[model samples]
Target: MYDYLVVGSGLFGAVFAHEAMQAGKTVLVLERRDHVGGNVYCETKDGIHIHKYGAHIFHTSYEDIWNYVNQFVKFNNFINSPVAYYQGHLYNLPFNMNTFRELWDIVTPAQAEAIIAVQRRSITGTPKNLEEQAISLVGTDIYMKLIKGYTEKQWGRSCSELPAFIIKRLPVRYTFDNNYFNDRYQGIPIGGYNKLIEALLAGVEVRTGVDYLKERALYRNVAKTIVYTGSIDEYFDYKLGQLEYRGLHFETERLEEVNHQGVAVVNYTERDVPYTRIIEHKHFESGTQPVTYITREYPAEWKRGEEAYYPVNSEQNQRLYQQYAILGRQEQNVIFGGRLAEYKYYDMDDVIKSALECVHKRL
Candidate 1:
């Protein structure tokens, strides 16, 4: 019998299996998908690595987590400076001086602040919904041109109908910095995320295209402890209720030219446009290949069969997840970890940190 039976060979499962193996434990990693790397999987085309699922930029302030990933593959300096396109106008992201200059020709911070301050005064009382919350934080222009369309498309609802707490803090920068994340370390692995997953599960036995839930009882006896990284609600057969999530559908294209969009990511902040953003894959690694690949991300309503990308952290969903969490905790010798289990939107670094912490505490 194996020491641990790890379900879902994503980053979390890979890390836990790696740790368990390092401590002289046998691990059997079962992935429901066909590949090993999970959502971070990349497909190589014409020497250019294409982010198959979506663009995943590794960024984190935690030094240990940064160092942990670096041991597998070398990372190049790739700062995520995604641009936003609204009504045929291009603006620098993160609401910086460059964006202000493009928006209203305001060079200094005071001038930009004055414009925002004047616009913010339009809010009469406490913010009622996401629309009011956003206008109260960053004024009307940015809200209409930048935030509204994208937010609406993502959650499949208008900003006026969404929760006010969603726009609690829109990251605005006084500096001209276009770098999206404020992390110390940010970049993709040299070849692809597959390299990192391969290195992590070097000795661990992995079976892809295997659905553990189909024969969970049989799999449970194959190992001493079970580390489940799938949906917690599904683990208990959705006894309480089904949690909600926001999904995405990608349409990728192979362009004949060397580069499609100069930048890696571009946000289309227009309500008329159906897709949220377009990601040029080669730009992530600065590849100079002859051909390029681009993917258009269309936000969609999530269901059980479709892949759940982001959790819908609505009050009702959170309440339902809490009921499931209590049931999950009662499972003997079973551990629930990762985004699906916790129902949280986790960055790459956060998932790695969580997996490491789980190993330390449980193992």
Candidate 2:
């Protein structure tokens, strides 16, 4: 009999299982996917590491969490500097000064500030919806070219239709820096995320191609404590109601040329583009491979049994999740963690931190 049965080989379950193993507890990790590492999983081809899910740049200000990950694998100095492509023009991201110069030929910060201030006055008083909220923050110019279509593609709804609180903070910087994340620690794993997962699951038993809910009784009987990293609503068989999510379909291709698009991530911010962004996989690690691989990320609607990517944090979904959370708390033998289980979005570092906290609380 195992002390802990981890439901998914994702970061949350992997970290908790690793901690449990360190404490000399027997752990069995079950994953529905063929391979591990969850969303951060990468497949290598011709010496290029392609981000299977999407471009994930690990960035965190948490010192202990940063140190904890570095123990498993070495991290590279790859900073996320995603460029936005709009109507045959590319602009630096994060609403920085470089973007301002490209957009309005402004060398000084004052010119950018003056232009933004005048544009922000387009909306007055309290913003009504996502459209007004965005305009009130960055004005109509940036909203049209950078925000509108991209966001529409992501959420499958227009900014006008979405709630204003959805886009509470749109970071606008007046600097020449193009670095997307403001975190002190940021990079990708040296080899790939698979190595990190392998290290984390060292000496721990893992079974892939197995869905816990399908054979919950069998697995639950084998372990004393259950670490569920799958969907919380699904764990309860969607008894109350099904939670909503936004899914993504990736169109990956291998280019004949050595380099394609020059950068790792390029956001297609135009409505005509169809897809939201195109990622050049080789650029993530500056690979000098003979061929290049790129993935065009197309946002789609999420349905049941389809891998839910981003949870749709609508008011109804939140209330439903709260009900599930209450049910989860009452399940004395089970633990619900990670993005999917919690019905919330989490960065890679945040997931690790939460997993560690769970391990501490349980053990």
Candidate 3:
């Protein structure tokens, strides 16, 4: 009998299993997907490593978390600087001074400040919705051009319908810097996330393409404790109803030319565009070769059996998730974790930090 049974071999499951095993416990990891690494999974074709789910750039300010990830594979200096496109106009993201100049043709910081002041004065009082919140933070021009359409498309709802809390503050920089994340450590694994996961689960027993729910009784009877990283709703058979999530559909292609898009990620902010963004794989690797691959990311509705990418996190969804959490707490030997189990969206760094904290407390 194993000491721990980790369901879902994602980052949470893998990290927890590794930690438990190091504590002299026998661990068995079961993943519903055929492969490991969860959403961070990458596929290679013609010497190009493509981010199968989406472009995942690892960035963290936590030194311990950074050091923990480095134990598996060397990371490259791949800082994320995503560009925003709106109405055939391109601008540097994160609302930097360069983006301001590109938007208004203003040369001096004083002029940029004056323009934003006027825009901010036009809107007054606490923002009731996302539209007003964005306007208050970044001004009307930037909001209308960059934030409005893109956010609307992403959430599949109007900005007015979305809560103002969703966008508490829009990051605006007076400097010319356009580095997306302000974190101290940021990069992609030298090989791929799959390799990193493999290193983490080196000594642990792993079985992929095995649904834990199907063999629930058999696995549970053998293990002393269950570390589940699958959806909490699924674990309880959706007894409290389903938690909502926004799904994504990817259309990937391999091309003969060395490059497609100049950058790793390009955001299509225009509302008319069906997909949110397109990712060029080789750019993430800084690869120089004769072939390249790209993937178009389209948003989709999350159904019961489909892969749920991002939790909706609306008022209603959060309320429903609270019910699931209550039921989860009652599960004596089961621990819910990761983005899916908790019904929340998490960046790579956040997940790593969470797993580290969980290991410290649980193990």
64-97 in candidate 1: lDDT tens per residue? Answer: 9989999989998999999999988899898999
* Residue ranges of candidate 2 with Cα displaced over 4 Å: none
Question: Which is the better candidate, 1 or 2, if ranked by lDDT?
Answer: 2
Q: Where does candidate 3 have its weakest 10-residue lDDT segment?
A: 216-225
Question: In model 1, which regions exceed 4 Å deviation?
Answer: none
Question: What are the models' TM-scores?
Answer: 0.98, 0.98, 0.97
Candidate 3, residues 31-147: lDDT per residue as tens digits? 888999898999988777889999999999999989999988999999788898887778898889989999889888888989998898777898889998888887899988888
Candidates arranged by lDDT, highest first: 2, 1, 3
What does each candidate score in C-alpha RMSD?
0.9, 0.9, 1.1
Q: Clash number for every model?
A: 0, 0, 0
- Give the Cα-based TM-score of candidate 2 against the true structure: 0.98
Which ten contiguous residues of candidate 1 have the minimum total lDDT? 305-314
Error of 3 at 196 (Å): 0.6
Cα deviation of 11, candidate 1, in Å: 0.9
